[model samples]
Target: MQDPVVEYINRHPNAGWKADMNSRFSNYTVGQFKHLLGVLPTPKNVIEDVPVRAYPKGLKLPKQFDARKAWPQCSSVQDILDQGHCGSCWAFGAAEALSDRFCIHYNVNVTLSENDLVACCGFQCGDGCEGGYPLAAWQYFISSGVVTAECDPYFDDAGCQHPGCEPLYPTPQCQKQCKDLNQNWVDSKRYSATAYRIASKPYDIMTEVFTNGPVEVSFSVFEDFAHYKSGVYKYIKGDYMGGHAVKLIGWGTSDDGVDYWLVANSWNRSWGEDGLFKIARGTNECGIEEDVVAGMPSTKNLVVDSAVAAEQRASW
Candidate 1:
């Protein structure tokens, strides 16, 4: 049934990757896959851009780098999230990266809610589950800010009673109230001081991640990506599915000399190589090099509350 993905892999043994039907998306329609990929095309910038930080001359980037290994203290970068059946990858990506930066820059582990952005960002970010611009998600972070997931947990995987359990679920309502009866929204929100696109060059992207932390990126996802099982991935065969946003964790060269970008997907740990995949790097594979977005976490409207951190540390 999913022979095409395997056929392509078998024909290209040196393709540096393999595919299988482990995802159970074999029965998924093209529309279903496309709908889950939420990154929309880039529109005009509505936010501030920061100058790329300059590094020391003759700086040498490590041949291998992984955010999980580099910053083991920041647990947020190690978590693999599930976006479920929703087209909220853009929100998920932006929120995830901002959360990591909060831990890296501020030394606190706070998991920001994609639900807050997906439901509330509205036109500024774009349609919640239908699709959205990656840049707009970061812009929304600067303006409206987002709450902690503990305050506004994702609803997609909840029971059938909740609307999020339905297929192609309508966007959740933009409610500022927290799920916990005790917590309120206004005080729980976290802000970003700034947001911007990284220059599309490989060195520029690599340097940004290597210097600060992981960043959010949107890339073209093809059909064959759905069956990815293991190894450094390079698209071998498939129709264009849609744009997918993910957390760019690091970069490295495979033993075979293939340069790859280490990415953390929002599709849960079961979907790929333990909820992560390596895409061809330096080649702008699938437009991965384009539309990179990230932000510096801010404490302007909110603080990285210690009690909330205690709760997160317990739950996480």
Candidate 2:
């Protein structure tokens, strides 16, 4: 007889219900999914000891960053199958982007704490593993200040809890009754900057904005929750992912010459191809430009070609 879990996944449209462990998680009932939703990981991971310094002024942009340059070299996103067993793709999206931007700004590769954002930012914007907003979360981080390290993760799980788990910088709690609409705080200095004007593209905008500093982007990843051990991913049948999270770093191309946005995933390093997966460009998921924000050179100060700019601004 066919496995019941496989049967359920098969019955699901696009096979979206397949769990990371097809054999184990495949049989998860709705109640189990709900239970996984609220439970937090035990041990929080710690942030690497790094100095939070001012962003370097006048960083250069590549001649033209596209799928050609984005996949194999600049960045990568592996499916973090079961970090929290919670489906909070929103938190992952913000945390990963910050990690990449932080690393790039400092020219160092370090993992930032996703649990910090998930636990603290949840009340203000993000959902507890069930999904949340990315841009709103970024605004939350910018206002809240440096997050606690992963070592003292907020949930109760073995993943993040460790002797070293603690925030490297001061972590700020959310302000009640915030006055900023769009839930964003305006910076007088940034308001006067040129980069603020160019943050319009929603796809690779994270890469652009992160080049100046860290920015967050959100998208859905619930379909990735099940049977994620395999490196080869085939879009499932009925598995309906109601939006998840991941972070954007840089762009690179896959071995297949396909353009992909590089992302950092929190699903431990075991899931997809050693925690790196390439996603299509120009579309929503890995398309970093889909959720563009302001104040980055690539995003803000594009030396637009006269013709293209004129064509676009004709309506003006």
Per-model lDDT? 0.82, 0.40
Model 1 CA lDDT for position 50: 44
Tens-digit per-residue lDDT, 174-258, candidate 2: 3332232333222210100111212324333533543444444434334444445432234443344343345444554545454
User: Which 10 consecutive residues of model 2 have the lowest summed lDDT?
Assistant: 188-197
1-316, model 1: which lDDT tens digit per residue? 2577787785785778988776546556778778889888766555344444433446588999999999999989999998877899998888899999888776889899999988988888888989898888877888888999999998785412354345567889988899996988987888887777788888888888987799998888888888888888888888888899999999998888899999999877777899899999999998899778887777666556766545544531
Per-model C-alpha RMSD: 5.1, 12.9
lDDT, model 2, position 185: 26
Instruction: Give the local distance difference test score of model 2.
Output: 0.40
TM-score, each model? Answer: 0.90, 0.50
lDDT (0-100) at residue 122 of candidate 2? Answer: 57
Clashing pairs in 1: none
Which sections of candidate 2 miss by over 4 Å?
1-82, 106-115, 126-130, 157-215, 222-236, 285-289, 292-316
